[model samples]
Target: MGGDQAPQMVVAGLRQAQKLHPNISFLLYGQEKLLSKLIPSDDPLRAITQIRHTDEVVTSETTVSTALRSLKKSSMRLAIQAVADGEAQGVVSAGNTGAYMALSKLTLRAIEGIDRPAIAALLPTVRGLCVVLDLGANVEATTENLVQFAFMGSLFARYVLGIEKPSVGLLNVGVEELKGHDKLKMAQLVLKNNPLIENFYGFIEGDDIAFGKTDVVVTDGFTGNIALKAIEGTAKLLSNFLKQEIQKSFLSKVGALLAKSAFSTVKHRLDPHRYNGAPFLGLKGIAVKSHGGTSAYGFSSAINVAVHLIENKVNERLAKDISLLSQHLVQEMENLSLAIEKPTPIKG
Candidate 1:
């Protein structure tokens, strides 16, 4: 109900998602009358689905705090509430992100040993797919937060992307040791030392993201958000630039026509729809967020994400991994705190 396409696109996408994940059932949460129209009473999937209707919705314009306080009957709130109440295994939404995050955090809270949740999304790279985390979930990530992101991101890469030994990399200005902020420097030590974290590459620069230098890229929300936007903007610019250039000349147009299949493959590979869902990792319950402006196909992809997490028991995996790294997480936070509090001796 909150996405740009709202009930229409939501209904169509759910139908398409049913076709994709035939084994899994669905539960729609929105105005029953509107959603009922989208799924006829005779539809087979409808037989498996149940709608928990609510008149309210979390709009894009609504503030997160306001939505949290006022929106008791909102579709987004009810959907997440289902997950919290054990009625649903997971929840997916293409609604107001801030509201979704706030509501989810408030309702589900973070898993034990996890300070906060990081938004993790799969991205297509030159070599294959890469998973990036903290994409606008937490504006500032502490040392412990980044370390947790690394663990959660690696789990996602292995379970979802099927990378056998997913290499982890700290997103930094340089791959060298002495070049990052204190938080990154501290997080890097833990990542390198943690045995559960396999193939721990020390650090990676921005360009390495597209090359798939590592399977999972970890960073604070501010940098990750900027990088995500940059990747999106670059993809659009290149596609548009190539189309304009091809149209300028008859020979180029003919060449493009001949290579049309190749171009189509590239376009689809880079299409945002292919990788539309972002999971709020580290939460006790599974919650996925889709791009609000996405199309029906994109929404279907988001549903796919939720199904994957639920089937794979992603939260359970993350919890176990977090426990594995608990000692390291504790030690590192204490070390960093001490470093901050300790005073430097006067220079000679």
Candidate 2:
């Protein structure tokens, strides 16, 4: 109901996801009349799927206030509610991202010791892929929040991406420590000193994201969202330019035909659909957001992301890592207190 191709792509994608995780069933909240037409009675999903009809939906224009105030029965809200009520293990939605995030916060709340949640997503890189966080969640964050994000992102890369000892980096204008804002400077220091994040890389630039210099890159939402969009736009621009240039002449067209498999490899490696889900890290319950405009394959990938996180118990690992971070902070504060209370040398 929320996406551009709602029930059609939703059902199609779920069918693909079903093959991957045959044990997981679904409870879809949408218009029954429409869904009945889209999902065939003999389809495999029909065997494992349960439909809950609701006309409410969040749109591109739906405000967060409107959703919270009036859309209780909305599909997105109900799905998230299922997670809160212990009726579901996780949720995947291609609806209004803003509304989804807001409702998720209202219902699921942030994991204890987590100041705020960050939208963490995977980006393809030269060394496979890396995780980038704070994508359009919390436009501005304090140093403490950034430090928390570092820990959460690290756990995400390790648990979901299956990377051991993930290297974390602060996204800055330069690799130099003194190059960014005061908050970044402090965040870097926090990560560097934290025993939990010993693999911390001080700073990394935009190019580092694609180069895979680090396994996790942390930044505020404002910068992260802009960088994410820029990378996506550049990928599309390059793809379109290649196609147009290849069709310019008969010889080039023949070359394109001959090099079709090579092009396919490039396309598959760079396809954002392959990495479609962005998890709201630091939430007690799992909620994955899929791009509203993506196709069935892309949505299927998003579903897999949710399934992987749930199966891996990422939030459980995140909770333990955060406790370690908190313990470190407490020890540092106590040491400072001891030093402050130490007797003065009497100006000797």
Candidate 3:
């Protein structure tokens, strides 16, 4: 319902996923009539797939909470519920992101220790990969929330990305400690004090993102969203520029032919289709959220990510680690509360 291609790309992705991993099962959640038209008749894919139909389709007009309330039996809700009930290992969608977030939080709930769920998107860098978190999940977040995101993101890099003691950095205006907003300044302090995040690499600016200065970059949604869009926009602009340059003259066209192989390699390296999905962290079950502009290739990449997350048991692992951390913070807060509540111990 959301992406330009929708069921068409989704159906193609499903076929490709089945070919890649025949054992994996998929529960297609959407309008049955639309899905039936896209699905092939007498195809063997039907054997491994199940369709859960819903009347309501969440659109841009649909408010997050409103969509959740109005479409109790909607496909998105049912898909999330399937994961919560252990019927499915994960849920993938290229639908309304806000609606997906709301429904996921409502159905699967956040992990015990996580104050707010964050969306972590993987960015390809020269070194390898970097995980950028809070990518438009929560518009406003506290210093404490930022600190928690660092820890959780570190764990994700370690367990899922298989990086040992992954470095964490605060996305800021500059490398200097005092360059960012007040929230980031305070967050820097909090992150400095937290022993859980071992590889706290101080502050990193926007330029550092693609350079891979750190394995994880933490920021509030407002800042993270802008940065993500800027990077994506630049990538597209550069690609277009290269094409226009190559078509300028005969000599240039010959040069382009000579560089075609290298250009193709670079395109594949920077292609968003290669990194099309992001995980909504802190949910009880795995939920890989694909971009609304996703193509069949992009959707297929997302399916691969979903398989990796499920096989790694990312959600359960995150839950256990974050739960322990949360309990400690809760106890610490309780002790402070008691100290404030006490009447100075009767002036002892």
Alpha-carbon lDDT of model 1: 0.87
What's the TM for model 2? 0.94
Model 1 per-residue lDDT at 257: 95
- lDDT scores in order: 0.87, 0.87, 0.82
User: Clashing residue pairs, candidate 2?
Assistant: none
TM for every model, in the order presented, reads: 0.93, 0.94, 0.90
What is the Å distance of residue 212 in model 3 from its true position?
A: 0.5
Candidate 2 C-alpha error for residue 135, in Å: 0.3
Candidate 1 lDDT by residue in tens digits, 242-262: 989999999999999999999
After superposition, candidate 2 runs with Cα above 4 Å error? 175-178, 330-348
lDDT of 2 by residue, 1-348 (tens): 357888799888998999989798998889988887777788778888888899888887999999999988889999999999989889999888889999999999998889899998999999988999999889998877898889888888888889989999999886343478877766766677788886998789999999999999999999999999999999999989999998899999999999999999999998888999999888889999999998899999999999989999998888877877877766754554475469621111
TM-score of 1: 0.93
Minimum summed lDDT over a 10-residue window in model 2 is located at 339-348
